[model samples]
Each structure stands twice: as C-alpha cells, then as structure tokens.
Target: MENKRKELLFSREDIQNRVKELGKQIAKDYEGKKILAVSLLKGSFIFAADLVREIDAPVRIEFMTTSSYGHGEETSGHVKVVHDLNMDLKDYDVLVIDDIADTGLTMEFVLEHLKAKNPASIKCCVLLDKPSRRKTELEADYVGFTIPDKFIVGYGLNYGDYYRNVPYVFAFVD
Candidate 1:
C-alpha cells in the first residue's frame, strides 16, 4: 500500500447506522424464524459481527472463506472455496454476508454451492456493492453501501492485506 493515498468513503458512525437498519429489516423479513448467517470470511468478519448483534432475531453464525483474488487487485475470474461450512443448509434460511460484491462471481459461486444443500431460502447481504464491476447477473438482497468502481480498503476490506484494521472504508486516491 506504499505510495497509495486514501480518501474516506464511509465513516465508522455511518457504517454503524446502516448496519443497524439492515439488521432491523432483515429481522422483520425473517420474522419468527432463526437464520443461519453465513459470513464470507477475511473481509466480512467485522461487518458480520456488528450486523448480527444489531439484528433482533435469532442468528446462528457460520464462516466460509472463498477466494478469487490471490495476492492481486482484480478477480481471477474464478472462485475457490478455501473453507466450507460446517453446518448443513437444509431447511435453513441462510443469509450470505460479504464485505463487498465486486465482480459477483464469488457471491454467485457461494450461493450455488449452498443452494445445493437445500436451504429453505438464501439471500445475500453485502456491506458494499460494486455493481459497476459486476461480471455476473446477481445482486445482494441487502446492501449497506453501493460504491462506484473504485479500489477500496478498510472496514474489513484491504489493500495488500494492510488496511483491514481501519474502522472506515476509503478509496485509493493516489
């Protein structure tokens, strides 16, 4: 990340408020049911943790690590499931959470994989949605922020794995 400059995209307060809203809406949508919160790891960990707490419903958390970018900035046009879910998806309402939906390939792949397990229903929730760069016909059910086609880091997103600790989202400006 050397020589790269960052500009604020979302502040900590902004993320908190939006996450709470998403949580409430999701809770209402899945009323009277417990949901299996499937968080796509490495990037969505922080967001997922905060989101689940705000949601006023019963949520059992799970983490799956999928990769398409191997030490690079762009997607490799393919996805690999580094780690699979431990819980069975059958008869469960699953919420797939991710930090960002950039090319859509990863989320689509993940959805298809989980769908095979016969989950009652599956929906996607992403903290950031970059539809401009989407290479697949998919959209997240809940999006905290719809960002432009900019390389971003922070708020669990990272550049060269360095900015994940930042509490806000920022875009490369230099």
Candidate 2:
C-alpha cells in the first residue's frame, strides 16, 4: 500500500513542528491586535485548529468554503463560495489560512472577495506551497512547506476529498 502511494513528503511530526512554529510567529505578530483567523474550510480545517491553539492571544475564528475544483482535480480558475464568514470585518486583522497554495486561483478569489469587506488587514498562511504549479502571481505570507509539482494528499490535503485523514503527506501516483 505504501509503495502504491509513492513516498511520504511531509511526515505527521514534520507538520506538527511547523504548525507550532507558525503559531508562535502569528502570536508574536498579533500580540496586542485584534486578529480574526479566517480558515478556508474543508481542507484547512485541521491546520487552522492546531495553529490557533498555539497562539496565546485573544482571537476570533470564522470559516469560508471556496473551491475551484468543482468536480475535477484541476483548478477551474473560478472560485465559488459555498459558505461565508460570520464575522463582521469592520476593524480586524484577518489571517486567511489555507491548506495549500496550488494554482493560487482559489486564494486570489477569496482574497478579492474578503478585501471588498474592508478589513483592516489581510494576510495569507498556508501549510503547503507548490510553487511549480502556480499559474498566477501570489505568495503566501507564511508557509509550512514548499512542495514540488506533484499531487499531494494527506495531513488535510486531499484528492476528491479523500486522504485528508492521512497523518502524513504523500505523492499520489496513478
């Protein structure tokens, strides 16, 4: 079974250590500020939860579900919002958390939509960054790992909503 999955990219312990570091950085940066963590749902759920716990400041949480992979593995270059954030962004520093930044279309779409609400600030944090597959000019403010141009699954990353429960990251070979 392991052979069929190629090789482990990032192990479970690897992600945990990185997430802890990211949380510390975020906590220090927003020490005395009103931070709102807007986690991209379905994929970033686990990462966001773990990250927020490491922060030692008062912060609020909200979720936004957007997908450019409507029914396929490739990005459609168009994002659709399935769920919106519940918090009002009148005066808050918003940190958009995502599982991975692939083609960057979805993050770009979400960023634009969130910008319209007039938040005080908006920053991006991703668990994985696949620079090879990027089709747009976008960079994550914080990233846990920089992966190659392969379809990865595990540690909340998935294909068709599978392998998200896998404890480690692995390349999918078909």
Candidate 3:
C-alpha cells in the first residue's frame, strides 16, 4: 500500500496548520452569525472535525454523503445523495466543506440542493481545488490548497476506501 504513493503532497503538520488558519478566518467572517458547518462526508469528515474545534464561535455540524465517484478514480458525471442532512437549513449561514473540488459537479449539485432549503447564505470550503479538471465555472469560497490535476489519496481521501486513514495526502505512482 505504501509503494502506491508517488510522493507526499501535504504532511499532517502542514494540513493542521492550514486548517487552524481557515478556522480563524471562518470564525471572524461569521462572527455573531449562526453557522452551520455542513460536511460532505466520507472525505471531509476529518477536516471538518479539526476545523470546528479551532473555531472559537459556536458552530453546528452536520454530515451528508454525496458522490459522483463510486469507488473509482474518475467521476461518472452523475451525482447522488446517499445521505441527507437531518436539520432544516433555513436561516443558517451554511458552509459546505468538501475534500476536493475536481469537476465541480458534486459541489454544484450540493449547493443547488441546499439553496432550495432557503439558507441565509451558502459558501464552499474545500481542502483541495483542482481547477484544471473543473467542468463547471464554480469555485470554492475558501480553498486550503490549489493542486494540479492529480489522483490524490489519504487524509480522509481514499482509493477504493483503502487509504483514508493515512495522515498525509499523496498521489499514486502507478
């Protein structure tokens, strides 16, 4: 499994530091506002957990599982909501947190769906952004890192659910 990785892209320490910075920024931006941190699951859970702890302001957390990729490297261009949030998004400042914005299809689907729920505002925060692979014009409101088009795994991202526990993010060698 170790041999599959080409090289490390972001170390655990590096990611933690960046997450802290993002948390601080989010706290400031949403000061005195009701924040609901909606985590797109199976990938961004780890990031969301860390981020919310860093935020000084009170924040509610929710999880939803939406996928364009079903245990594969590339998306099929079809999004599915495997799990939905339990709470109504009305009046909450919704911050959608995701692992990566690759083709933008998943994010677009999520944002549009949440918009119908009549949230006060909606914004996206992504751990990684690969604009080169974007099929839509959408962009993340807050991006932890803008990476080149690479098949990345680890740090809650995975290859067939195998490498999510890895502490660092890396690309596959072969």
Clashes of each: 0, 0, 0
Q: Between candidates 1 and 2, name the one with more favorable lDDT.
A: 1
Candidate 3 worst ten-residue window by lDDT:
1-10
Flag regions of model 2 displaced more than 4 Å. Answer: 1-3
Q: Give RMSD to native, each candidate.
A: 1.0, 1.7, 1.2
Select the stronger candidate by lDDT from 1 and 3.
1
| Local error of candidate 1 at residue 131 (angstroms) | 0.7
| CA lDDT scores, all candidates in order | 0.92, 0.88, 0.91
Write down the TM-score of every candidate. 0.97, 0.94, 0.96
Tell how far residue 140 is off in model 3, in angstroms: 0.4
Q: What lDDT score goes with residue 81 in model 3?
A: 95
RMSD of 3: 1.2
| Candidate 3 deviant stretches above 4 angstroms | none
Error of 3 at 48 (Å): 0.8
TM-score top scorer = 1
**lDDT tens digits, residue span 70-158, model 3:** 98899999999999987788879999999999999999999999999999999999999999999998989999999999899888899
